[model samples]
Target: MQYRWGSAWGGQRLLGTENIEVAIINRGRPLRSVVLEIRGRSPNGLPPVRMFQEIEELPRNREVRFELASYEMPDEIEELNLSIVSSTAVE
Candidate 1:
């Protein structure tokens, strides 16, 4: 299945350190094997890892809340990367 990351349905930015909730919206056939991981880079470095989680099958076009992370405002996360390794991939 294909994976999409966002704060909501199709959001790219999660302003400030305010408990950001991310969802992995899936669209495609049922996935047999799915491995996904997200890493964020900030000026202060990894901040205690408030939340981190993953899932296997997410309904087509539906969003599955991956996890939540609390970040401080003006933190300006340098990078937010997601890598999904599965039977089907679109990247």
Candidate 2:
């Protein structure tokens, strides 16, 4: 699985600031309630920001998209990180 920002209109923005977008792909078995941890930092050397999110359900070989907004973030992000915090597979 991988993550990246979406297009201009596809991203989520609050009051035309801080556009955020994410895509999660499931290549293994079916999963339920998948949790994700996202981290990022601005160029000004401010403390990093972390965010957590979950996907209700994800099937094998499928993908999901998410749009997020953060007022604390600037329009351009210098560094960003994404990781799968936890997930459970459905038999």
Clashing pairs in 1: 17-71, 17-72
- Give the poorly placed runs of model 1, Cα more than 4 Å off: 1-15, 43-52, 71-76, 86-91
Best lDDT among the predictions, by candidate number: 2
The lowest-lDDT stretch of 10 consecutive residues in candidate 1 is 1-10
Q: Estimate each model's TM-score.
A: 0.49, 0.76
Model 2 per-residue lDDT tens digits across residues 1-91: 6566643366453344545677677777888888888887767676777888889997787778886676646544566788888989899
RMSD of each: 6.0, 3.3
lDDT for model 1 comes to: 0.52
lDDT of candidate 1 over 32-72, digit per residue (tens): 35566566667676562222345655556776665444433
Each model's lDDT comes to 0.52, 0.71
